[model samples]
Target: MRTKQDWEWLAAGSEYLAAVAVRELLQEGKSMEAYEGLAFLIESMGKSKKLALRSQLIRLMSHIIKWKCQPERRSSSWAITIDSARTEIEEIQEEVPILNRDYIESVWDKCFVRALREAQMEMGKKKCQIAALDWAEVFEEEYWFEED
Candidate 1:
């Protein structure tokens, strides 16, 4: 009596419910069903991980856009955020090896557009122009507070 809702739990990040469902299937000797459920769970978790990675990328890019647009108002807090997002993105990639640079590049344009809009709204500017971001500058460049 499997329905779409059975998979919805996994998609919604309900790992406990998913585990219980799989256990029940296994106990009933429905090995094939249990294996399929596990496969779906893996795919759902990968999507979740990739979404989190995208969020971090957007946050990092938005901060970089702000940093570029308003250089005069730079703060150490912003730098820390940028660093933290970069680290988290890297960690996600490490944890999920399938999500590599190609995946990041694939979503880069969409993430940049979201980031641009977010940065513009946050800056309270009705019209703020942000040039295209360089991949190396955004991910590779080090941003730090200068010693005064």
Candidate 2:
């Protein structure tokens, strides 16, 4: 029987090990311990998914801010990055339906603040004058790089 600390350490290092331990516990008829470990794994996976979504959101929002703030400096790569991030965020939400618009809305302010700060830093500006982003502006607005 592994201790709580053992499970935490194993999970932190490799989820595979934690999962294996849970399987072993089940085979040994330790149903209660196996259940607890499975629950922990589920919670950890959910946290990871949320973090992934937040990362994509931050990337998308920051690039959009940069595009708006520095139109003169915009390039194809920026447009591509913005597009990619949007696609990835949407894909994540689709795969994990629990992370829907409501979840995005829940973390909007914090993600925006982080994105704003990152954008300002990248653009070498101490402050950016951009306003808060609405869902439509971030996800629905068309941002394309038309080749001439």
Largest lDDT belongs to which candidate? 2
In model 1, where is the ten-residue run with the lowest total lDDT? Answer: 2-11
Candidate 1 deviation (Cα RMSD): 1.7
lDDT of 1 by residue, 15-129 (tens): 6677778899999999888887877777778878999999999999999999888888888999999999999999999999888889999999999999999999999887667
TM-score of each: 0.90, 0.92
The 10-residue segment with the lowest total lDDT in model 2: 1-10
Pairs that collide, model 1: none
TM-score of predicted structure 1? 0.90
lDDT of each: 0.87, 0.88
- Give per-candidate clash totals: 0, 0
Runs of candidate 1 with Cα error greater than 4 angstroms are 10-13
Provide the lDDT at 103 for model 2.
Answer: 96
Candidate 2 lDDT, 1-148, residue by residue in tens? 6677776777767788879989999999999999888877777777888999999999999999998899888889988998899889888888889999999999999999999999999999998889789888799998776655
